[model samples]
Target: MARQPLAPVRPPCRLYLITPPHIAHLDAFAAQLEQALDAGDVAALQIRLKPAEEGDIRNAVQRLLPIARAMGVAVLLNDRPDLARTLGCDGVHIGQEDAPLAEARRILGPDAMIGVTCHADRDLAWDAAEGGADYVAFGAFYPTATKETAHRPELELLSTWQETVEVPCVAIGGITVDNAAALARAGADFIAVSGGVWAHPDGPAVAVSRFAAVLAAVAEEI
Candidate 1:
């Protein structure tokens, strides 16, 4: 058979920053977040505080939302569409266990961005896309300490989705400067990183800048 031409490259992949499961010092973390966002092309920030009181969640949002908005970065609350709505967040990210896509859509309204965690499930991705999700996420392409990940999606999943789906796909889990370029080339529209940025040895700002550099290189190659 003759060689086949590749599909047209999708738009460059951008960084999606997810907050740590816990933010011990709100002021310190907020300042770090501001620096990180200022350092690169972050598409959005997900305020994902686990086992936190509703009050803490609200406080974090109150403190961090303005910083993100000031940099033109969207703010998303993980697994809390109601809070997202009441707090005036730009969107919400829901896991398969968190809420049904339909209910989330109804709650957030048509304008809000809602992303579904499809993990490595093709059916889940398709269902979310057909159900009007702004985006579908797949991961953990690499092992992540941020959370336990049972599903490890293959790079081919991203490649195939790029060739077919109009809804953007976010490649999440353990993504860092070292591994991000491959994900970008594999067709991830956004690469979600939590520990990769926050836990970096140099600092969050440097980590963000490095990821930006990696994505830039991938964009030029494609």
Candidate 2:
């Protein structure tokens, strides 16, 4: 049998939500995910399950993927190419600390989208592309209220990655409507957010829409 074609990359619009494993009320978050889709926000969702439980992650992904697909949102599983393959997700986002690119590629075959975390390093981005990653992720652009990590990626690095790599570059950590355009100007192809979207006082729906609106205005400029 032949493979399916990848979805055309939508012009940078909406937020990309990375779900934390600690979300106890999965149903509530499912509603939020539905809203993001309904509002035309959230281009994609990354199901990041910490502490690694394939069963639990698959359950969450199963509940979320249908909602996401119905709304035309792409769903990515973080760190597990096997699970992504089993569940037929849109992609897998792996870190430098995770599985090797070749192993992931073999499991996911040629069609699955692969995103690699390049951290703050340019060489890492180059290596990931050579290793078969579809997109590169850079992070801690602003202080993160979520994960605690020592490394902070600079805006200049975004320019460097954008210029040096063919794959789309994702800018993560503390991104919001206020700072999104600058990141976009810095040439970040995707703005990946967690707290910035899920922690907003109003709701994830509004927060994602705000980021989407910001991206829309910036896209027009470029």
Candidate 3:
């Protein structure tokens, strides 16, 4: 039998709910994940495990994968391609400082989703796409308390990028449900977030659901 074509994973709607390493309640995290899935704005869940330690990340993947998979949310492990494949995550996200895109693709195989961080430069994004990235991330569009910006991308870059690249484009950096529509209008395929969902006063589940709603709202307008 011929191999079936893989269904395309669309870019995140308007809001991309991100997972952080710190969660006060494990059950709450899972519940929040369920809420995000129910909300239906999510494109993928990036499991950001910092400090690049194997045991630490493995533990995180073990805890988070079940929740994501249960909800049919694609999981992308940050910075560690090997661990991502090992943990059965759908993809790996690499920063410019992390690993090469070709390297990531080679390890993850042809069909695996691999994302790259290109910051603000259009040329960089083009390079990443040529290098075999499934998606390209641009960020620090807004000041983020979570991670300091090394290079900032201009808003116009989003429009330019959307036109240039066939691969999905992700706009990251301190995005919240409130501001996500602008990015969506600018043609971002995905909106990567870190603190927005996790740091919400309403709690993670509400945060996730809220972001999801925001994304849906944006989609309706389009």
Task: Give the per-residue lDDT digits (tens) of candidate 2, residues 1-222.
Answer: 899998545355346778865667789889987886677566788998787566778789999999999988789999899889999999899987888888899999998889998778788888888888888888878888778766788899878766666778889888877898999878888889888777888887888778878888888876
Model 2 TM-score is 0.90
- Give the C-alpha miss distance for residue 207 in model 3, angstroms: 2.3
Per-residue error for 40 in candidate 3, Å, reads: 3.7
Candidate 3, position 201, lDDT: 82
lDDT (CA) for every model shown?
A: 0.95, 0.82, 0.78
> On a 0 to 100 scale, what is the lDDT of residue 4 in model 2?
94
Model 1 Cα displacement at 3 (Å)?
Answer: 20
TM-score of every candidate: 0.96, 0.90, 0.87
- Evaluate residue 161 in candidate 3 and report its C-alpha lDDT on the 0 to 100 scale: 76
lDDT of 1 at 56: 99
What is the lDDT ranking, best to worst?
1, 2, 3
> lDDT tens digits, residues 1-222, model 3?
999999655454554556775555656676767765675556688988555567767777788788778777788988889888888889998988887888888888999999888888788888888887888889988889877688777778888877666878889988876887788878888788878877878866677677777777777776
Question: Where in model 2 is the C-alpha error above 4 Å?
Answer: 1-14
Number of the predicted model whose TM-score against the real structure is largest: 1
lDDT of 1 by residue, 97-151 (tens): 9989899999999999999999999999999999999999999999999998999
**Residue runs of model 3 more than 4 Å from their true location after superposition:** 1-14, 21-28
